[model samples]
Each structure stands twice: as structure tokens, then as C-alpha cells.
Target: MRARNFVSVIAAVGAGVALVSGCGQGGASGSSGDSKVIKIGTLHPMTGSNAGDGAQLQHGAELAVKKINDAGGIKALGGAKLELDAGDTKGTPDTGQSEAQRLVSDGAVALVGSYQSAVSANIAAVAERNKVPFVMDISGDDAILSHGYRYSFRLQPQNSRFGATAAQYIKDITKSKGRPVTKIAYLHEATAFGTGVYTAFKSEAQKLGLAMGPEITYDAASVSDLTTQIAKVKASGANILVVSGYYRDGVLAAKAVQTVKPKLDAVIGAADGAFDQPQFPTDAGSAANGYFDVNYHLNDKSAEAKAFADLYQAAYHDKARASAGFAYDSVRIIAAALERAGSKDPGKIRDAIAKTDLNPLSLSNGPVTFDEKGENTAGLPVLTQIQDGAPSVVYPDNLAAKTIVYPAPVQ
Candidate 1:
């Protein structure tokens, strides 16, 4: 029941206090009566374009399971060991659905991950039908929780929250720089994740009375070059460009800026997508230097969050990813739920997850609590700029790693 991790929740792991209240030793699962093992399935992309992200998320869950088992597993379940049942989504919806079935068939009482919004939706459906408890690590599309399912819970903020937060960040950034962001341009992928963020942001922009310009939506998969889309952004004469998409598309968008070379003050983002991933700087080179992305990130200022960032970076041999922490926390949360429920029955696990309220050791955010819709009520997003190649937290004042670099010199 230790609350620790970063995107799939991202950060390094460090020292933290013992977590969660446990029910005295009891049988966690009917199957565990003999094997004394509680299985949790980790569903995420292990192949395809988002494979790198999936791999990171998978490792996060692996580390959590290791940490839990190393500490004597679930004490309430007669010290039953936690077993991770890993499944590959292959970064596709159909594959994701199939994988969920595979995991459930293998006797997983709980599940975590599958990063894409679309894929997560598919897995969520399977988990719901099978009556398995699902903890979604990272898939921000708002509709995931709108279906009124009782079994699935999200550990991150909804996509709509990202839009409103980004709009407010834009206003603050412009005001600090003494140049008001008047006209705004919108660019996003056509997928649910992309379109959902943009739709919410557009509504927020309208409320702010900002003049809207060209809004371009394109497929992130086939659209390698964004000249056709950037052309519209350029012609719109907007000082700010708000983009939504994943890493590959974000790189294309940044390159498009180089190709079209718009005289833009800033190109902010709704999703970490391209900017927050480690490969972004290496992929985009100098172009990623000035780009700022707004997404959920670790508030490393807290001792617990700092501990997690260190642990994740050291264990993975790479800096913590934007989504790693949540994934890690999700697994731990499920494990804690198992301890609280004292039963492996899916319904009991789901009930325990609903009452979870431990402070996450992964990020310096709010306590881990769920609303009626199965969304984390404490989830908060962060703004980051690619400062010298790595994402540096720079917003919300209290958790900032560095100050915002207004008008980052065009590379």
C-alpha cells in the first residue's frame, strides 16, 4: 500500500514512510488460499510506435511489485506474494482488448496501464465485463470515465483539465513577459486524445475572449511532414500555437515550425506527447530547446516525489518519464487495495480502491482519492520547458524546478 511512482505517475524513487492501513491477515483471493500469490496484470504497449512509452510504464509496475514483494508482500493476505502478469497491447485498440482477456484468463485480480486513450478504453471495456479491478495509469481522454463503470479508476487528471490549466498558464506566461497572447492557433491529432484536449482548450480560449485562428487536425500516424498544417498556423498570424498530439507528431510539428518558420512567440502543448519524452531532444535537436509542454508531471520538490524520481531513474537507467509515476502508483494502489479488501475477489478489490486515500510517494500532489466517476480527485498537471534537453518543472511556483524561459531563443 505504499504510494510511490511518476507517469505511468515519472520520477526517481527515494526513501519514504511505510504506506497504507492494512486489515489483519486475511485471504486476499480465493485462489490464493493455496498458492498464496495475488496477481496483478500490467497491460501496456510493448511493440509499435508507442512501445518505448509502454516499456517504461511496464518497468514502473515491475519495480513496484519488486518493492512490495521484497517488503514481504501483502501482510493482510497471510503475507501472500504479488505476481505481475504482463501483457502487450502492441499499441492498438484490438490488441489491447485481446491482451486484457489474456491477462484475466491468467488469473489477474487487478490490472494497470495501456497508455493510449483509445487502447485504455478498449481494455477498460474488457475489465468491466470481466468484473476485474482496473487502474488506468495514463490515458487522459475525458470519456474514459463517462461510461459510469464501477471497476475502472483513473490515476491522472482528465484531458479537459489539461486544456483549462494550459489556457491559464498561457495567460500567466504572457502577462509575465509583458506581451499579451492575443490570437491563438490550434493544432492537434485527429485521435480522441488529441481532439479531446483541443476541444476543451478551444472552449477555454473562447471564455478568455481570445481571438481564434486556423484550427488544424491531422492524423499523427501518416502525417510525417506538417507543412500543410503549419502553413495555416503561419498564415493565421497568431503569436501562440497550442498543439495536442504524441511524441512523433510533436517532433513533426516542431520541424514544421523550422520548415515554415512562423514568427511565433511560443508553441505550447496540451499533452507531453513529443516534448517530455527523453528521445525528443535527441530527435528534435535544437528545435526542442525552446519548446514548452503542459502536461501532468512530478512535483519533485516533495521528499517522497524526489525519492521516486531517483529510484525510477536509477532502476531504469533513464530519467523518469512523464507517465511512469502514475503507473507505478497505480500498481501500488491496487496492491494496497488488496491489503485493505483482504480478498482477491474482484468486487472487493474495486470497493477498496474506491476508498483509497494515501498520499502518493511518487509525486508532490494531493492524496490518492477517487470520485464517484473513478477519477483521481487529487490529480494535478504541471507545465514544463525543455531546458537544456530535459523537462524542467516551471509552473505552479511551489513545485518549480526552474523558472520559465520566456521567448526561448529560436534555435
Candidate 2:
């Protein structure tokens, strides 16, 4: 059997286990005019609290794989076709490490996942040990890069950048209105992503002369009522609210604040709100409106972004979120690097990806260049708002869909 056929057979035998173990198990057979088949593995939380996030990312990666393959496979590899193998990490750090190790052992040349930061931290060590490149799609904690893993590369900006952007936006926009920035409350989940952004935003807010208030941490898994915390923020008379966490916690936080009817000047979020998932607006009600966030895309109307968005909707019948953009950009970046490298050698691929700079595939809100620490130097993000029911870019003026709406209407 040809390698591709053998791999397919393995996959068919054990969809769950084979996904991680199918690496080089298949016989590399099939003739498509000097085309070598390259394998890339995906490790994501296929089941767990973050299952929805992982599944969405999986589809995004799949779409990218299909588009790349259809574009004549890597021409630099003499028309080599890229192959995708996926593993279920179950959204745990241990599982991420195990899945990454399995992919490397199975002969996968590169990896593309571990959507959560805690999980990505585990996967990075395994990829480093095996000399395989792990191109991250969503994980944005600064600690992921601080570890100094040479074999890892991040396609998305870090949580720190998002926090910094939030602080700066408040400073620039608030100052323009001649309003004295008073109290700022930072809210976060107990998760690593949340904690990291909390720290980043606190420091940035302080540096920008914004007074900081008590930090509010919530339980990510089960926090039904955050009324107490929201009341505290309201009592503090904070003018600014900086929230950090994924959709679930963000939704709850927003709703909690609305229930308490806080008189706040501005409400901003980090990558946690990058995707304006329906649940946020639905659950949070009018409190969600005018909620600003630092996210991947600057606006929905950029020619490049609009094209991708239309294609995404046509293909999936749903709107593309921040993770989708991260996935697409990661795939394109890896494809370009692999093509430039000209071989499936892991070390070579790592070097090529590390050297990625100002890539055209990079978004307009920022450039795409990897620092020595494996973090993207162009981490600039755009501020967006949940206006009415959709996310609209509202900062970095040229790309904004609407003017800044501060002192959001009280519910």
C-alpha cells in the first residue's frame, strides 16, 4: 500500500488513537509527478470545557488544508502534497503533551495546535525535545514564549499585547475626550489565559497613569452569579473595566455587571472577546453592547478580510471568528515556510518559520514576524466593539466601523 493509503487505513482502524499515531505508519505510495506527501499533525481539545473552541479551530485548519492542497500542494517541494493528522487533546496539559509526543513519534514533521495556553505550554516541550515545529493557532499567554522553546512558533499575538492595547486605547481615546481616567477594575478567570492578561493589563494601565482597582477573579467552570464582584466594581466607582477570559466567563461577567447596573466609563476585553460568539450578546443582553475588545482583525470590511470572510461564510455557512483567522494565517505561514525550506526536515522547517517576517499573509492590524523567543513581534491589535449584535472594529480610527461609544448606556 502507498504511504497515503496505509495512513488512511490506520486512520480508518482507529480514528481516535490513529490520529495521533498515524504519522509515518502509511506507505508513501501514489504518483502525482514527483510530489512528496508531507504530514502535519493537529492537537486540540476535541472534548472538554473548551470543546467548542477546539472544534471550530479543527474546521478552520481543515479548510486551510483543503485550500492549500488544491493550490497545487507545495510547489517548492516539487509539488509535494501536505497531509493532516489530528489528535484529541481533551483540553488538558497532560493530554496535549502526550498527543504532541505521539505525533512526533509517528513521524509528523510539524504540529498545529494546543489551543489553550496551559495545554500549549505542555506541547511546546515535547515538540522541542523531538525537534519538531509546533505552530500555535490560539494559545496567547506570554509565558508560552518566555520558556524559550526554539522548536515552537506562535502565529497569534500574546495576551500581554492584548492587555497593552486595551490600556493604550483607553488612554488615547479617553484623553481625546478630556476625561480624567479614574478607577479601573480588572476582571479575570482563574485560568492561565485570564491571569496572564490580568497581570499584563494591570501593568500597562498603571504605566499609562490609570488608577487600578481591586482585581476580581472568578471560577471559570461554574460561576452562576458574579453579582458580588460586579457590585464591588460599581462601589469602587471605576471608570474603566478591563476583563480577561474566554467566552463563557466573559458572557457571565458582562451579564453580572448588567444585573448590578454599574456606572462605568469604558468596558474592554482581551482575546477572550476576540470572537463575538452569539452566546455573549444573548446572555449578557444590552450590557454586551459597546463592549470593546482587542482582537485579531481590524475591521470586517478590509478587502483581504472581507474576501476571507465571504469565503469562510460560503464554505461553512457561519461567520469566521478570531481563531479562524489565526488558523488560516498559521496554515499559510507554515505552507510558505515549508515551501521555502524545500524539505520535510523538522529542524529546517523550524528555522524557516522562525525567519518569517512581514508576511503578506499577516493581517493589516499588525505585521507578522517571530521574535527569538518564538513570539510575534507585530503584536499590535485593533479594538473592537459588540455593537447591536455584531463585532465592529472601533479603534485605530481608519479601520473603525463606528465612532467610540464610551460611557455605555446603562441597562
Candidate 3:
């Protein structure tokens, strides 16, 4: 009887140990069958105001997984195929945190996603707590990387960089067009994403001798009209109007500008979401013409990028946007890290990502590399303009697809 009791106690302890081990390393490195697949979690707002953008992000990651699996999967791990575990945040921070937790509990070795800055912040905290590596696909708030968290990596240029680049582009383009910037009206959404870009733009514009005023803000989720705000911009007598906001709100602002007819020398976007979108021209109608967005986009000149775009279009029957490119690259980055790590341990994967050095399929200042803060040191944004119903690069002569038309002709 004593021997049987001892045996039962030992069995219980072993079971508990197994349970703990399973939770720590996830299922990717488990049983022989499980080790044949790696699970990667992706969080995005698939059912909220930003659903369209979220869908693109998810699809990009999906396409990347397909490409890798088709090419014989991860070579280091015996060609283990990648399995994406997608979660919907519904554009809320709480949902994002919860979804991240669920994904980790379900055995995701790494994570990617979340377009909104606020949502990404919450997801980042979760990643740090769980010691999981998170590669942000589109979130741009600089503060997200300021937390000193080693597990969170951002693929997009910080908001501050985006703002400064936009300002510099504005200065160079206006001067070359013989319509040097003077007074500028600024409009942005009321959030870290929008406000962060605006603050940096204001500082850069000041240094460039560009007077700015009539700064306006709107609730991106609630605001329905921007006419009164744009009317204020027109009354300020500002020669240029600079906008910072997401896709839905961006389109609304564009229509409002068309209605108000501010007659400004130029209307440009500082990391504006809607302007660089493939459907922006059609969605904004004639208002999209002459609209310029200084933001990150796919490198159309790269043959690899061209092939990816073709694959995306052929698979989805729509052109892949800048957001999609980032998401696709995020997956590729993870796969590369997995190959280097030769293990499915989250910590090992995180370390491998820190040393990443691969040429991206998107526009960038250099190859993909992460800094001490997990920020992509080589991320870059370029100026894109809407001409004849399509978005084309038009600045920084090296990447320009078309000559810019400044002081845009009256519609």
C-alpha cells in the first residue's frame, strides 16, 4: 500500500511538470508531429473601422506563409511548415491584449500585427510579459519602442521619422516648383498615431522656416464631417494643407477639402493612411488627384517586389498596398529568424530577429536590421502622389515613378 501511494504521487508530479513545459515552449517544438509545424500569431482589427486595412495585413502574412511552404518550408527545422494563428482585435486595445494572450496560450512561438498604434502598445506589453517576439506590421507611434522591451520589433519608420521626412519632402518639392512653402495648415486625428506625427512635423516645419497654424484635430472614430475644420484652414490663408490620419478619416478629410476648395498651393499627407492606398484615388474621386502622401510603400523598382505584387494581385485580385508589404515582410523576417535559430523557443527566435540583415521587398533606406530598441534602423518613407487615378512615387528622384505636378491644376 505504501509503495502504490508513492507511485501515484510521482505520477501526479510528472504530469504537472509536463503541463508546465508545454506552456513554456509552446507546441511548435513538442511531439514529432507538432515539431513539423511552427505556429505564428497575427493580431489585427478585422471587424472594426480599420477592417479593410486589417484584412490586407492578414492577407499579406498569409501569402508569405504560402510562399515559404511552397518553397519547402523552414530548412533548419527539417522543413517545418509555418502555421499562422490569426486573431481579430476589433480595433480595441483590450481585445488586442486578450487575443495576444490567447494566441500565446495556444502555442504560438512568435507574433505579428496590429495596424493601430494604440492596439500595438497593448499587444507589445503582452509580448514582453510572455517573452514572445512581436514584429509590428504597421503601427508607427514612436513611444511604442520607448518601453525598452526587447521582444517588440517595429518594421515601419517611427512617426517622428515619417513627419520629418514629409517636412523635408515638402520643402524640397515646393522650392523646386517655384512655390516655396510659406504658411501651412495642419490637420490630424486625435490620437498618439496622429498627434505624434503632427508634433514632429511642427518642429521640422519650424526649422524649415515654414509658418504653421490653424492646426485642427478630429476624433477619427466618431467624427463624420471635416468641412468646418477645413473652412478654418482656408480662412487661415495657408498655402499648404498637411493631413495626418487613417484611411476612413483621411478620405473624409479629402472630400471635405474638395468641398471647401481651400485653393492651397498643395495638399499633402504626412504618413497619411488613405492617400497611399491603392483605392484612394477611386474612393476620393477627383479629389484624390494631385494628393500626395509621404509614407512607406513597396519598392516598385525591385524585381522581387514586382513578383510579390503580382502574386498578391493574382491571389486576391487587388493590388497590394504598403501596409500589406510590411505584413508580408514581417512573416518573412520571422521565417528567416526561425531558420537561424534552428529552434522554436521564443527567446531564441527573439535573439535571432535582433540580428536580422535581409533585403526587404519594400522601400527602405537599407536592408532590414533592428536596433537596440527593436526598431528597424533601415525603415524609410517616400513621397507618393496621385496622378490620373493611381498612386506613384514622385520625389527623391531615385524612386520617382512620375514627375510631380505641384500647385496642382484646378479640378
* Per-prediction TM-score to the true structure, in the order listed: 0.88, 0.86, 0.91
Candidate 3: the clashing residue pairs are: none
Runs off by more than 4 Å, candidate 2:
1-35, 274-284, 298-301, 358-362, 365-367
- Residue 18 of model 3, lDDT score: 14
Best candidate, lDDT: 3
Runs with alpha carbons beyond 4 Å of true place in candidate 3: 1-33
lDDT of 3: 0.85
User: Model 3 Cα displacement at 130 (Å)?
Assistant: 0.6
- lDDT tens digits by residue: candidate 3, 1-411: 001121232243232111111111223334334778788988887776787788788778877877787788899999988877778888889999998998898888899989999999999999999999999999999999998999999999989998988888988988888887768899999889999999999999889988887789999878888999999998998889999998888999989999998878888999999998888988889988888999998888899899988876765666788898899999999999999999999999999999999888888889999999998999888999998799999988998999999887325
| Candidate 2 lDDT, 1-411, residue by residue in tens | 011222343333332211222222232233222237677788877666566676566656665666677677899887776666677787778878887787677667898987788999989989988889988988888888787789888877888887787788888988888876788888888778888887888888888888999898887656767788889889888888778776666777787877887888767877665335534566677778878787666335557656766665665555666676677677777888898898888899999998886443334535678888888777557877777787777788877778777766456
Going through the candidates in order, what is the number of backbone clashes in each?
A: 39, 5, 0
| lDDT at 334, model 2 | 81
TM-score of 3: 0.91
Evaluate candidate 3 by giving its C-alpha RMSD to the native, one decimal: 10.3
Question: Which candidate has the top score in TM-score?
Answer: 3
